[model samples]
Target: MRKIIENYGSILLLLLGIALGSVIGLLTPHAVEYIKPLGDIFLNLLFVSIIPLLFFAISSSVANIQGENKLGKIIGLMSIVFLVTIVLASIATIAVLYFFPVSSGMASAGVMESPTADNSSWGDRIVKFLTVDEFNNLLSRQSMLAFVIFSFLIGIAARRAGAAATAFTSFLNAGNEVMKQLLLLLMKAAPIGLGAYFAYQVKTIGPQLFGFYAKPMALYYGFGIVFFFVFFTLYAFLAYGRKGPATFWKNNIVPSLTALSTCSSLATMPANLDAGKKIGIPPAIANVVIPLGNTLYKNGSAISSILKIYVAFSMLGWNFFDWNTIITAIGITVLVTIVAGGIPNGGYMGEMLMISVYGLPNEAVPAVMIIGTLVDPLATILNATGDTVAAMLVTRLSNEKFAPSST
Candidate 1:
């Protein structure tokens, strides 16, 4: 009991926090504002950490991988698979959300002011949009594209420096190490943060929110799992053949479970690396893919985008957005997921800003935040499992592609 508690301490704490918050909120309704500040503190802590964490983790990983010649093929194959998986996950999420639909027809819970100020004039809005950095500062403070562009520039410079770049590379590597430790510390506080957030949500929103919202959230999570199986597991079976899902699960399940239980994909890295090797993926590929995948190619965030859109349509009874809107939403979600995947708590602010860009009604923001906090552990499980499967399949396909040409 003690061992299990120690092992799963982070997840346990998160849930405990939620449970406590719910009870307190139910008992003292007026104190909701007091607990709300805790949520703010938690979110601020997470936001401050995400950008630096993502930049170092991804930039350093890229620099290290460049030292290996075979990495190009590995990256190319993995990127193709990653893109396909995200597209499929997006489709699945949208389809399931459409079917399960979270429509309540009820007005939003409170008299909340619009987060956005009046865009009364086209010129004013255009001016704001044209100066994107200014708009982003107003919106979320952290811009995903900006982060990616910055990281890409640093990574390119590091790669070009060759032998001379060792000092910079070491700095990034050290940053990664420090961030890993800091993430663990934050995760330990997850229960408290999640609990406060959860309690505030439950107290303010009540049980009806779940009845009205749970189906779509469940559909979102279901799509994530379905894509993990279809894209990752199915490809593994085709590539491995004699060694199928059974074998892949045998090798990767422990780490997947660890990721789910702990809700920290970074913490599960050593386990995932070991699992990848056990499943017959080369050590070089495993080392390269798992860390990089953790930094990018987040399958779960793709599903979140689909789910968020669906909720917006259902909640506001807004006119169905056009195909261009859908495509734009999916595209932005994919880009943000890649850039922000490495950051602890990066998704919150990014997605908050995304709601407006996608033309989603702001009423959906609280619902999305709730989903982000609750669904994290399960999402991490699906992501890690999917990544391992993709790595194995990519390795097997690369081997076959280069094999002797029998004319």
Candidate 2:
């Protein structure tokens, strides 16, 4: 009973929150509005924690890479694989949207004010991304992409610092662990916080929020399921042919289910590691690649990001076929998705980047958040399962012999 609750508790709580929130919204709209602050406070807490979480988690992971001789090769190969998969996923998203376009009726939804001014040139935006005032950017929620870049450089420098880096790396790792504990504590209160927020959302938008976004949601889930089976199978074949494909499915079942239930790839890491061992991946490779991949390889989020951009463009009546728009959409999707971690609503930062980079209406942020929240389980399953697949590829490419091993 304890084990079952431990596995399913969070998902059950989330569903309960949604159901109760909807009822309150319908029966007591005014009261729901009053409860909105609880939700706002919860969201603000999450936002405040995410910057430091990304910084320490990513930098520490990078700083801990053990094989100095093989580090460059391993990281390069893993990155190539990650980039290729994300690009393919993005293309799949574009193709899916092309076939089943989002409804223009989304324009009728209430538009929030666009947050940033739209006068910045592409060159100016690029410059700002690379050279923001570090102290100021650290405080602003909008600077996550820059923050990730800065943290990554710091991590690499720490890796090169030899024995002197151990203390700093230990500190970052400890900080990351503390943040995870904080997240768990927050999650325990999520039912109340999310319930209040959802109630307010239903009150403001009416229950029609679901119907308003139905078509795009359908597209997202439909394509997501298709991609998971097809893409993972292809990856299995590339890693080791027929035998590998069979092992992939057999090993991934538990991790896939955990990811789906938790809606969190990071939360699924233990299961992924177990699956990696079952499938004969070397522990050395699995340990390094799985953690690193959790931070960097986000094919699932890349697909979701593409869909968000399409939905935003559909709502705004932008020309999707424009070359400049297409390039920007794909580029930012890849960039933001890389940093999209496994927390619920973790993709919010990525959505903000999309809005800023594409000059999207700030109102689109909430819509994207709604979409991400609804489809998080599916996205997470793909993200978590894909990490194991990446580990397999990395192991095979590195010429690491697959001997069946368990912790």
Candidate 3:
């Protein structure tokens, strides 16, 4: 019991907070006016942190990409594999959500603030979504897409400048650490913040708030299991035909367990590297891929991002079937899952992206942040373990026998 708490104490505390708040809200609906502010304050603290966090983390990760010393076939192959896998993962999520749709109806739908419809042309919307008119505008949450684009450019510029940008790179690295620490400090209040937030939601929206999650939560976990066994097997087979699936599965036990137990992709690296070597991924490939994968590859987050977007859309009373929305959701999934997955509390950053991109009200984030949290354990398994399989796929395509320094 003590061991279980140590591993999962935070999640348990969050759930307990939610339970207590739910009881308060349901028993005394009038308490919302008093408790809602706590949730709002917490959410604001998170929102305030995202811009600087993304600016530092994304730029630093891109600037410090390990493959710069030797980037040719292997790096190219890794990029293809990462893009293909994340796209496939998002498509798989879209298909599942299409069939077993998440519940959307809240008894008090008015509790959610809806964005006013923008009847702009697709071209205009695209430009608006991806760029800000003024530099100052980029700092606001509404310009998250623009800010992300800017960060990537900054990182690329720094990388290209090499020795000239050493000081800038150091600053980015330091800033990333500072932002991570700040977020960690802030999250010490999650149990209270999320609990109060949920309480306000339950009181305003009624207890059906829990029911709204029942199907989607169950479906996410259920699909994660199926995706792990089924799609991962398919990826493995593609990597090393016939015996590949067995080999991949047999070797991944430690990495998978490490991912679950430690909940950190960086923590699972040694085991993942060992698993890749056992599966015959060349050192050149495994060395670059596993470390880079922690920062840029995330099959698990792809699915989770898509689900969070869909749930936010559903709650906002938007049409999920709209072609524009579907395309945009997939695009957002690839960006957030890969780019944002490296940082601490990145899920919340990703949620902020969704809310900003869709013009959804602030309430949408709290609604989806819980889903991100609950799904994280399973998500981390796919993410950490998938790197080895990805390395195999790269190996299969790049030829089986290669020098260790071929990368």
Candidate 4:
């Protein structure tokens, strides 16, 4: 039906792209390599827009937080909840790994020379993050965290600009809207671009990639499902007591499914907004929190980060169980997930951070990318679901009526 197609057209196209790419790679890999450039071009286009988009979107959101009373309280509560969820996700990842330990053989046996490895201590890494050249950092993907920090500060300054804050916030908001429109336009080519990319990926890595990672991937998904049910159930109970569980699922199933199909929290925002209304969340809270959570609240991403770190350390024959390493991994996972964008393959940025901070082998970069891409949809489902639950909690804590009483 036209309605069904309209509702799910993008996801269908992406799925078709993936399928076609796999077939081409399997049957005529030599020919498929020629089209790989299309995928690269698409990725390049996305990378080009990311920095400005981050600045506008993140800064504007933070700046606007000043306009609403108790919005800060909502944000404060949400922050604690978000951090708790991420920590829980990390704990789940650790527990899963204990039961289904990743084999060392998942890593390529060949040794790779890492060009980015350095002798910087954790303190040095922190100092470097806070001391980057602002203009230069904005122009480079390698300085994403630094750029994020700069954006946050700029947003706070804009918020405190008194009467001038309104115009500044409007300008940044317009820019953010324009960037999102640009991304949507580029996504129209996703079928062709992502298909080509996947074809080349299959050709280069072959089926063996899946075979080697099967157990680990399975473990990730299994634990992810457990986390989703456990956390959301508890969140619902806390927000609305007995009726909360049913209401949460009733309203969120569609949004969760949309996120799963698109692997994009940003794309699922409209549906989430509608779901928030149906569940009695105040429009003011939903407007602020859903968008903010899209960019910052990434419990799913935190779990993925933790999983990737575990795999990377296992590959490198490092002691993952050491207290120091465990604590450091938790810190890195929290930070990286906070900065992860809501686009497909957005976690690639976080993976890069992991590599730089943890001294992971350069070869592990590609492996992490591949793994993250493969699991993006499920991760996104958890992310979208969490956003809705967050809205519920915000509604409860702010003591707002869910819906207006019939006049």
TM-score per candidate = 0.60, 0.65, 0.59, 0.67
Clashes by residue pair, model 4: 280-402
Q: Tens digits of per-residue lDDT for model 4 on 256-315?
A: 755654566665565576577677777556655676677678878888888888877887
Q: Which candidate is the best by TM-score?
A: 4
lDDT by residue for model 1 (90-153), tens: 7666666556666633345323344454545747643443235553452333344445445645
User: Residue by residue across 364-400, what tens digits does model 2's lDDT show?
Assistant: 6666767666667688888878988998898778887
Which 10 consecutive positions of candidate 3 have the poorest summed lDDT? 106-115
Please give the clash total of every predicted structure, in order.
4, 0, 0, 1
lDDT for each residue of candidate 3 in 110-196, tens digit (9 for 90 to 100): 344344445677578668767888999998755655776798688778889999999999998898778767866876786787678
Instruction: Provide the overall lDDT of each model, using Cα atoms, as 2-decimal numbers.
Output: 0.62, 0.73, 0.72, 0.73
Off by over 4 Å in 2: 1-68, 111-210
Once superposed on the true structure, which residue ranges of model 1 sit more than 4 Å away at CA?
Answer: 1-69, 104-106, 110-211, 343-345, 400-407
Task: Indicate the worst ten consecutive residues by lDDT in candidate 4.
Answer: 109-118
